[model samples]
Target: MTNEFVLEAITREFPESVLLHSEPYGFLTLEVKKQDIKKIIHYLQDSSLEINFLTDICGIHYPEFQEKELGVIYHLHNMMTNFRIRLKVFMPRENAEVDSLTELYAGANWMERETFDFYGIKFKGHPDLRVILNDPEMGYHPMLKEYKLEDGTRTDKDDKMFGR
Candidate 1:
């Protein structure tokens, strides 16, 4: 029902799986082990918590964090109470793969595909994990911080006007 209650229940269920918990912007946010995300999600959905709605899913890339080079963010909502929660899982770039939520929420398919397209974080066990927005031949994740926001050879763009 409340953030504290939900967090307690989760912690009680899988204490080791939870890494961190926060209430940013007045919503429950939890960072858990990427490997245990599917189990946690399954509990949240089927347990009394009943976080049934998968609002959104996205990815993030932090090249500077050696072990946490890539991350996936999942938003779940309880329609009955309008309560929301965010779950995050991070992994290294070399092993940037996590269990798919498609089995729990069908809507996770496109979201997972888009995340894979942008961040190259593979969602293992997804039915059809492929590039949903980017060209397959691109062969690189575009959302990673390693890519430059502006090309050095771009003379056509005015940096002063854009506050760059």
Candidate 2:
């Protein structure tokens, strides 16, 4: 359906969570509060739209940004209408916790795992939360802005030498 209709439905069902609505690229993008993500996602899945297809879920980290140090972006699509929507939840660096959508969307399993692997944002109730790319010995998140090279050294050498 139309972006306005989808946004109206979201606002009606989740008055507290709908922070803002944006129509970028002619798609509905709903910015939601992190604390109310679970409820909002459930509402979207259960609505008449039935946007049960979760195309992707990714995380972004910004240490210098004041509003939110981290964010998790969810991309969902409606198979019946070919409409798409994006849901984003901003979170702080410390105590970053958001409800896992894996229960509602089984495809979220790998996406959430990848987000946790890169941004260190914990997905509560995730069945298998583990490192997807980095090794177990790596302590710092390479994606965050706070990440620093060891000893402040600069070189063109491969990172494998520093224990990649």
Candidate 3:
């Protein structure tokens, strides 16, 4: 179906859960309440829309956003129609946890782990939530904006050469 139709369907079904909606480059994008992510996703997958494919799940960091510092981005696809939709949920860095989609989509297990490994976003009820890429000893999430871009102590490299 058309982006307008999907947007209208989602907004109508979860009026309170949807915080914002947009169509960026003709792609339907929605910013939803963190607590209602699972419910919203379930509806999209099981309802008449049939957006059943969980294309991707990733984490994002926006240090300047105050309470909405940490977020999760979910990309869903309707393979039959080749349609896609994106959903985002944000929360305070201190409470970067959301419901796990593994129970609904088995493929979500590794995606959740990877998001957690990079952004430190916790997926509640994730069966084996742990660092999937980084060393377990690495206590911090490298993808966070708090990390510096370069090693300040390095003497062999010059910032000017890199056009920094």
The candidate scoring highest on TM-score is 3
lDDT of 1 by residue, 15-125 (tens): 999999999888899999998999999999999888999999999877788899899999999999888999999999899899999999999999999999998889999
Error of 1 at 35 (Å): 1.1
For each candidate, C-alpha RMSD in Å?
2.5, 4.7, 2.5
TM-score ranking, high to low = 3, 1, 2
lDDT of 2 by residue, 1-164 (tens): 88988888888887878887898888788889998988887877887889888899999876677578899999989898998999999878887778998899888999998889888999999999999889968986677766454555656654566544
Error in Å for residue 43 of model 3: 0.5
lDDT of 2 at 143: 77
Q: lDDT values of the candidates?
A: 0.91, 0.85, 0.93
Q: Comparing candidate 1 with candidate 2, which one achieves the higher TM-score? A: 1
Runs in model 3 deviating more than 4 A are: 153-164
